[model samples]
Target: MSKDTSRVRLTAGRVEAFTCPAGKAQAFLWDTEAPSLLLRATPTGRKTYAFESRLNGATVRISIGTASDWSLDTARKRAAELKQLIDRGEDPRELEKAKASHKAAAKAAATAHALTVGDLWPDYLETGKPKRRDAWKPRYLEDLKRMSAPGGEPKKRGKGTTRPGPIYPLLALALVDISEDALKEWHDNEARASKHQAARALMMFRGFLRWCATKPKYRGLVDNEAGRAPAILENLPSMKRRTDALEAAQVAGWWAGVEQLNNRTASVYLRALLLTGARREEMAGLKWADVDFQWRKLTIADKVEATRTIPLTPYMAQLLATLPRVNEWVFASTKTLSMAVYNAKRRERDATQAGRTAPAGEVSTVSESGRMSDPRSQHAKALLSAGIEGLTIHGLRRSFSLLGEAAGAPAGAIAQVMGHKPSATAEGYRPRSVDALRPFLTQIEAHVLALAGVQFDAQVEPGKLRVISAQ
Candidate 1:
């Protein structure tokens, strides 16, 4: 019989010797051992191992590899495996695709397994935000950064390196390893030093886990509720609602002590907190643009809303006019310590200079934020001088609520001026326009001033300073 040259057994030598005809675009040589297997060559001498077969009345050609990468015998064995899939009435192309998909899934799983919380924390901070907010507020964002900070740098106020943040330890943990048991252990360890700080950190971390769960790539890797596991919640410190406001009688002393403060700006800030019942930060963030002396109104940054306008009482307008327009801030920061405080610190440094010489440069009391930052230390000094114990900065806010009621102002009006969320039980709970809120605010201010024994003259020209006298 004549040699059947169309079907020849493939060999490394025969495959190498094969070439496409000069005028033809391509040529093929079929292996007798695996009839579906073929070595294909192009006119430019490119060659490859491929499996070609009929499946469901259509021809399917699958490229296995290049001629150099696969030996003749290995190519034949792979082709035989593909043919088996076709014989079983399955598409070899589909089988090859399934294998590729499984390989890709395994690779992705490996990559996910290697991911740590530290790797994704920055991304979370950048995109994650509280409900109804466009982005994290600057204060809250700083809190988040502090919670996860790796602290080895020198303290801002003292001698030693700062401690690592409460959440820093968890950053090294792999996302897949975050479990109820893991979080419970971390919470227990952190709660040892400061229960409230640890609890706050846990709350913030839960926000992180919630954000991660929303991502497709990180979905299955973390359990969003792990931070809130019952084991962890049970150990949280009992939350105590602070009731530390100035008593009606204590207001006279607080006012006197505040007026005696050496830092005039701090004295004004502390008094402003009491008079307006604004949160410390909200008051500190005040700008000159937000004050409207001509309209006898002040626009305050509200905690519950974008902004709230309240009538600027006579005393407050006069009080504001006394403040120098140092910068944009209604209460601008001086960024320097009072002469007495600075002298005391200098004396202490001189006393300790024998061991190690202090750095010889100006000591900045606080970073210049263009607005007043923490007045707590000065507030504490004021409290101590007044012989009033347990009164907090927020206590001033509570005091305003208590005193406003004592002054017979409606609950809704008090709530509105204080930037509190209105409730159904508050009288006239509906939102009142700034003008309608005027009489109530002025009434509250008058009552507070009377209690503090402050006498003020409101007869000055608009935008001019009105004199206030303390009895």
Candidate 2:
């Protein structure tokens, strides 16, 4: 052992040297008593802290922290700790390793504590909401509401029940708090009630966690939890293929049944779904502005990317011409119209009683003119009344796709009309223009209308059907 130069205070620009038979190295202790107090300098100018001291027939060494952060007090304190451990018959080297591990764990826990599921949800909404046209679809929003609270009770939005939104319950826990076991429990319980729904929830939750991992606050906590969660769906359940497509033979009978529907607006809405291959919500929420009569086109902002433009087949055009425009909505309600008229009447009476002249035509029976009805409740009631079995509003869009395919429309053209992403091969190519797609869309619309026995100008010449609309 080298003699201690107690008179000299270890400082920057000062180094102390010692030699042992084991190796010849110089210990450069920084001026401060910082954790990174010493550095071993080689004759070749390579510097490291590889110094060791033997205590009770065992070797012990300390790593003064890096030069940048070490202070004189910190280094001296660490050196004393190591010395005391050595004195107590503990291996200082083992003690150093244990201290390092505890520090690392504490640092990780601090980072985990800083992040919570609530913090990540807004980001998920900002990035993911664009994927949906109406971010709050009734069913999807309803699910979100259930997951927000502990018991899945519906929240009150003013006087009405708030719709559920996305984000599952387990996913809403703090990222650090979520463990593989918790996720497994949630998945198993959800699966018991509805396997397909559980599968969907897992997928959505996984996406949320993935977003969490990329954020600085939750980075380390998110990845491992998400990675460890078991795959909820080993395989998606197979759907039973239904041959529910309307046959040419059934066209006349279906039309007769549809015409007898008591709710004229619902009948028109269903026919529009079949005629234009528009999704039910798109047609139900159809506004007058979306219809371009001059261009013979109906433009719809779709759920996915881009707006879908379908040609207005002659039959569909004729149907539109006959309908009364009640409001901005294409299918406004009679009750709402009556309510508007009643309000106008009250206002007119107050004006007359106050000796003030009323504006002409302000109190007309057509007060709520040009608006449309909410198709959902009405459509359901109509379906029940018509005895239309195994049919849904969305089913019309699917039927349209199938019938279009059978009638020989290209898959890409059908997908574009249906607002689906183009297939990989098609995506590689330039997107087809509305004009380029017009002819195929016209054929599809004609085919669908024909399925409902609504004739158009295009004649389905036997061989021409194959050539004109090749699927």
Candidate 3:
């Protein structure tokens, strides 16, 4: 049949027969049935179906598929669709690109929806910082990790695998699926085990969700209000304010119990807490550099500021001066059996590696972070010995405030020494200098000593602990 050289009625036989000219790199045969439909052939016998059209005065070429994949009828129909798009003032290439982009976005959304709290926990822990602080405190950071930790690992101190943390179950849930219903159920389950711990875990998890809301990639997936749902809030246990502290009458017995303790450092540390009204952690974190023997002042790490300087009374100075200078810490824990064993193993390893005996007296003098930790049990023992009940280590701090007032010290002086933030009040809102606080502190210490029926000369040299009476 007569036909144009480059165009012809395409058929199964003609399609198979298409091939590039020997000298040409490629050739095309346009379908007469569909103007833009054509079969392209390379010299190597590779073939494909393609559509070509012009839009905005530029040619748009799109590969339909290979000859094996696109049937003659199917490729022609696709070519017809492309022509209709071009007629409607739409570029087929642009429409195809838009479809591809939409498909990719949908896929990304699906991926985000499948993300679990566990997936982003590491990133959150690394980047999430508390308000008013540059980074998480070491202790609070440890709490975060412990709250989310999976169970089945051996306990650090006791036998048996540790229980999963309160926040552990929620880690497996998809971020988007952490709805109010999900959280309510989670809180209900965890509260059954420990309401306070569950409440703490919920608080921590909410911080994580708030962090997620700040991130562009995770913002859409997290529901910040889910953690604050009324259902969860209603189930939370009522928080009770602690008012437990030593009464004036309990001082003598408590002092006697604390004095008889085997741990000399702890006995003095407990007394220091009562004498100075310092927080448990703040006093435990004291370093030698923070103490000023010459100035009779102590620079303690403050909750309200970077550090606070308080008058170091004669009694408190005597207590601290007697503590062993074992390390940098004023209340350093004694080296335990575990520490000795580990050090011995390490020394043996070093000797084996070097082919000689290790140096003498290489030992770790403290098991934990050089500072004293968890004196509650020891305090409990002393309380038991004294027949006192419900008095916490923090109770001693509260005791100081009450005793200091009974000593007739000004409210502001007591608050300043205890590192309390000053409030607007007639009682004394202004801060006090170290010298201004010294006499009041000394008065409070003398009052406490008399109430406990203990008499010791304040003029005695440091490192001397002499109690003439404990009646």
Candidate 4:
């Protein structure tokens, strides 16, 4: 028995090989039944194991594990295993794949037990929230709270009972534990209650789960469970047709109703919404600095990035002039008298955070001590008082757009003034001057006032009209 000394060892400066017995070298090289192992050296002097065998009249070479872990005995055993598979007409590659898959499955199952939907939700929000233009973060958190099931009801009568929303039942389940059956059940139940809500909740959940798969801790858990949930059937109820915009005639009636509103701040806020074609929040959140009275321009900080400047019509300017300068807010709350109130108390904190400040005057209304009320709440009250039905502060903005278009404002001009993306045609031309939009905004305000039959000045008062309650 002689060692061929033709093979290289992975360790530096070591070489070993095997020489077949006489008449066996060629037989060993070409025979499918016999397994042979060799060692090779690279130009860099690194060594590696090379196992060779003949299968179906073709020679194949495979590297057993690296020399650091593959001792001679282990290498020989691996080679023997390959030889056995070849003899049995089975590929050694298939066996390796099967073993790998089994190991992966076992590891995934072990990790899945520790991974929950709650653990992966924040990562999903961080990734997906940037893609939407709306304020979806607060909405998403609200949905999460709704989806979180309550332990029990409250004890007091006036206190609201704590109950989990429809999606809450599944939040406690691990990502891998959420089977198709469970998801289908949740979907069916949510759809049965309110298909629109169910659809939205499912979409958020699916997005969260997809994001989970990208993270290291919850990767395999999401891959197997969340990815496998069945798609919800589209047999849910039809959605209500949203009155997103008002028609020419309806705009008149609605405006007429708005004019009858008695609340001074809400009236001004609603008028601003119509005059600027700004979203409810943007107008409600307006600070005095955002308004350039000298220029007659209102700068609206949009929900999306970028600020838009809308030319204030004479009517809107006059409306602004009517309000006392009790606070930094253009629409200061009468309740606080010092601070501006918007949407009543609910949004007071948000208003303050948005830089609400006391005006350079003593507080007169509501004991001169309390913070201002939210203008949005006051706007809602005014709308209700004016006998306006099914119209929100946002509707006032939509009405402005529709009326602006009706008044012959160009679509691009309307979109630009409304803080929408400029059309391709408009982008090619130089940005339109603020003066160019002045006539259109002026027309829109006049149209709204005419519809509401409002008399901004004593000279404009027509015959008296009876007001009716919306309720």
The lDDT, on a scale of 0 to 1, for candidate 4 is 0.61
Indicate whether candidate 2 or candidate 4 has the larger TM-score.
2
Worst 10 residues of 3 by lDDT: 361-370
Q: For residues 350-401, what per-residue lDDT tens digits would candidate 4 score against the true structure?
A: 5577888534343323333322345566655655654556676677677777
lDDT of 4 at 371: 22
Local distance difference test scores for all models = 0.83, 0.59, 0.86, 0.61
* Top candidate by lDDT: 3
lDDT of 3 by residue, 112-138 (tens): 989999999998889898777788866
- Give the per-residue lDDT of model 1 (tens digit) for 119-159: 99999889898777798876688899999999998987659
Error of 2 at 219 (Å): 8.5
Task: Show model 1 residue runs off by greater than 4 Å.
Answer: 1-5, 9-13, 53-60, 83-91, 152-163, 247-250, 253-267, 284-311, 317-389, 410-413, 420-438, 460-471
* 1 or 2, greater by lDDT: 1
Over the stretch 1-471, how does candidate 2's per-residue lDDT look in tens digits?
323212235554443242122354443433334332355544554444323456778555666564335544555676666656666888866766899999998987886676677766666665544233546444454455455434434553235454333234563577777666667777777667777766667666766676666667666676545424445344445555655555555544555556566666666666777766776666766777888767777778675544677666556665665454556666666665566567777878999999999666432445445444355565556555545666656666777777778778887777777776655324353467777777887787677655555543443321122222211
TM for every model, in the order presented, reads: 0.75, 0.58, 0.71, 0.57
Worst 10 residues of 1 by lDDT: 360-369
Query: What's the distance in Å from true for residue 47, model 2?
Result: 30
Q: In order, how many clashes per candidate?
A: 0, 37, 0, 18
Displacement of the residue 141 alpha carbon in candidate 1, Å? 2.8
Error of 3 at 458 (Å): 2.4
